[model samples]
Target: MKNKILLVLIAIAAPVFFSGCATDAHYVQTGDKQQIISAGKINSQDFATAANDASRNLLSMDPNPLDKVDRSPAFVVFSKIVNNTDQSVDQDLLTQKIGIALTQSGKAQIKIVDKLGEDYGNIDDFLNDKKTTRRPDFTLSGKIIQTVDRAGRTRRGTYSFQMSLNDPKNRAQVWMFEKEIVKQGTRDAVGF
Candidate 1:
């Protein structure tokens, strides 16, 4: 009877062992249709989502949607974005992607405020010097915050990306956007 029970246990365990060992190499689309999603880390899809949301929000709230294209794209200056997450994250992972999308869509152009000043001289010096001054029409700034909660063996995390486009001339926030990404799984879960 003991031998029969042992054989039954082995039979049930065999498939699990085999399945765990089997891995077929395959191709996956970047930032989409992946079985494994990592938590506690930023990924390409997150950037894409953030950029898409910002672009869509900008277009939706555009005061003059009809002349959006006709009007010269506004010059965007990068402002300080706070990182409130525990993990070290590259801010460019979020800003640069949004900038590129905005540039490519012909809606806006990114002006490096620091670089521009550095190239000319300095902010104070530029103001004192008699040079052609090009002011940035809009400024992009925001923050990213991460929150983690776990239930038993499963861990869930939410990352919030907030961005705004402010009209420096009028001191008004012309456009605002936010995206929250939630990922759930544990470290031992090979495929999230």
Candidate 2:
């Protein structure tokens, strides 16, 4: 009778004990204070910060290349973004953010183009040669580079986000910007 009662008590208390130990899921805004940080890899917060900085600097240019275009909103194409980091990262995370900011600001329009500056339109349109694509005034390209340093158990990572705006007509670089983000933590310290 004692063993049976003990077993029943354990079964009831086990769930309550385990439930207290488990963490409940919650939603938080991007780049929140509670977001996880890693020393060896780029975080979402890092991408947001870099993209924000790039957009601000690009929009603040004195000459304002976007204004020099014949059209109200300049058409811009993304050429390529090279990733030199150790880990695989989607370049769209950075470009898409910048693109959204620029588009929302009404300064530039993003155009999808191939290497030859052909529009990536519908297959039927291409087959019929119904090319309504306008030549892009500017092309945007970038590269992400990562460097790491270690001292004992402490590890530090620095990521460089470099971008350039080029005048396709003149084939000259109109604007260039670089943002560096560094993160440091102990090897065993993984989460927030």
TM-score, cand. 1: 0.71
lDDT of 1: 0.70
Q: Give lDDT tens digits, candidate 2, residues 40-102.
A: 999888899999999999998878998899997988887668899998998788889999988
Kindly list the per-residue Cα lDDT of model 1 for residues 123-186, writing each as its tens digit.
Answer: 4443454447555666678888899898997888898999877665555777777899888877
Off by over 4 Å in 1: 1-27, 64-71, 113-133, 188-192
Clashing pairs in 1: none
Winning candidate number (lDDT): 2
List per-prediction Cα lDDT, in the order shown.
0.70, 0.83
> Among all windows of ten consecutive residues in candidate 2, which has the lowest summed lDDT?
114-123
